[model samples]
Target: MFAVGFGANHFIPLLQVYREGMASSEASLTAMVGVYAAGLIPALLYFGRLSDQIGRKSVLMPGLWVALVGTLILALGAFSQEWPLYLGRIIIGVSVGMGMACGAAWIKQLSTDDPVAGPRRATVAVSAGFGLGPLISGVIAEFAPAPDFLPYVIHAAVTLCALWWLRAAPETQEGRGVGKRKIVPPVVFTAAYLLAIVAWAPWTFGAPTTAFVTNPSQIGIDSAFPTLVQGLLAFLTMFSSLFIQPVVAKLLANGPRWLALAALGLTTTAAGLGVAVAAALTGSVWLMLITAPVLGTAYGIFMVAGLAETERFADDGELGALVGIFYSLTYLGFFVPFLISMLVTGAENVFGMDPTQAYVGVLAVGVVVCLASIWPVSKAAGYGGRS
Candidate 1:
């Protein structure tokens, strides 16, 4: 899970390199980030079912090889090639989607001795990968020789070990082929689940992503080491996510219901967006940095809450599929940057707002959207309570 996740987000900080090295357009750059979903959603939808049919080892081992292949593609792409980067990102997404389902499932199986710890550890492992990958790669990209290529080399090296490690891990699932059970779980379409899909899921990645990638350039940050700065923002957000999970666990220990956790997480994400608004308006890079952990806390809360909800709602047969759904929705947030870029350009042409002013409006709208979600989300929680 950690290695796959490292491959997943390691490409993010390199966007700056692509932009500067390849002279990529903003639209194309943002597409690279959003394009991850293209490969991820399909894998997410079925890898769960695939893992359920085949053993976890069968799905996971191949996924690691795919991850290394993706990283190598990225390294090659660094030689001023644009299409390779995009292709690499798509491939990385597929591998990540596989790991998200099967790796997590395998971890859960291994931790059968301690039921509650499995999900927590899985979350931590991937999230830590997400944070550190960018941090290390960003630094290396900033100062090391072959900035673009070296980071991928490091990641590929680490991922190679994962292949061996997972080889020794026991297989959890049998190749049951197709049972009478359905692939798409019923709970996913329920009103309670729909609330997460609509309201909570998008912002799961949206908030933290907006913090690091989207706003940094728009807010007039002219750092000497752009990659490092981006990496720090990502690092801060993810590490904060890791630290806050324990707090969330304690808060939920009393069983205050997932609704409160969802509401608070979304609302806090809104507040972070609100801060982002201030940061952009004032052109304060430091203020922008402050928003990273705030948004990340909300991200952490949502992750814990989302996984807990999956456990609550899914049967053993449907767990992987449900996990896939949860993550698929969150990956949608990757498109937030692309959407923001498009909207800002459109606003400049149609609404007659400058890019900076237009971006501020978009962020402000995000704040409102998050705040508004509280009611519907709570209603969903109410449904859960009633049932």
Candidate 2:
């Protein structure tokens, strides 16, 4: 799971590399990120359900190999073209989507005796992978020989080892899977369940997308390393949850489940407002610095709460399918930066505002949506006993 995830977003920090090398426009560069969700959504829908029927390892092995192929494609075409990067991003998404759905179910079953620890362990693995992928990719690109190609080669090597390691883990689902599992979980049809996803999932990635993708570009600074600022922001936002989630988990253990989710909604609302402020203000680089951590904090809380809640909603046969559905919704936020760019261009042509000037209203709408999500999101988690 970790290795697959590491390869998934390692390309984020290399935005400058692709932008300059291929002479890609900002819209196209951002599209590379958004297109990942395009591939991920389908994989989540299909491969995750396939895991339930065939066993986790069966699906996982092939997915990991596909990830290596994705990296190789990236390495081979690093500076030579533009379309391959988009293709690589899509393939990486497919592999990571498989890891998220199947690996989470696998880990949870491995820790079957303790339900609480199961989701925690999965989130830890995922969050760590998400954080470290960009951090290492950026550093290696900054100093390593063959900057255009070396990073992908290193990631492919790590993934190869992960594939070898994966063979040793015993199959948990071979003989144990429930017969006649549905491709889609029934729980997802419930209004409360849909509300949870609607209110929490999209914004889970939205916060970080804004933090690392949009924030860095909005606040310019003089730096020798092209990827350093965005890479650090990615690391900081992801790793912040690694520390904060355990505390939030402990809090949930001691208090009501709804509190964690309520906090998620509140923190996400705060993050949106902060994003709007940063977007609207001039020379708000420090504000971007501060907002990134808050975004990370929101992401962490949602991970713990969302996973636990999804686990709670699942029956014996439905775990992987439910997890798949949950994750597919989360990646929708990756399109945010792309949308922001499109809106900025459109607003400039129609309203006669520059890109930065158009950001204010676009981000303000985001803040409004975030603010309105609070109650419904909290209510989905049984706020006031309403679930």
Q: Which candidate is the best by lDDT?
A: 1
Candidate 2 per-residue lDDT, tens place, 256-347, comes to 65564644645664765566466447645556656777787787777677777777787767778888887888888899888878887799
Residue runs of model 1 more than 4 Å from their true location after superposition: 175-181, 196-198, 382-387
TM match of model 1 to true structure? 0.95
Tens-place lDDT digits, model 1, residues 165-212: 776787778655556456678777677778744468878898888888
Model 1: colliding residue pairs: 53-175
What lDDT, from 0 to 1, does candidate 2 have?
0.76
Clashing residue pairs in all predictions, respectively, total 1, 0
User: For each candidate, what is the lDDT?
Assistant: 0.81, 0.76
Candidate 2, residue 7: lDDT: 86
Q: Ten residues in a row with the worst lDDT in model 2?
A: 378-387
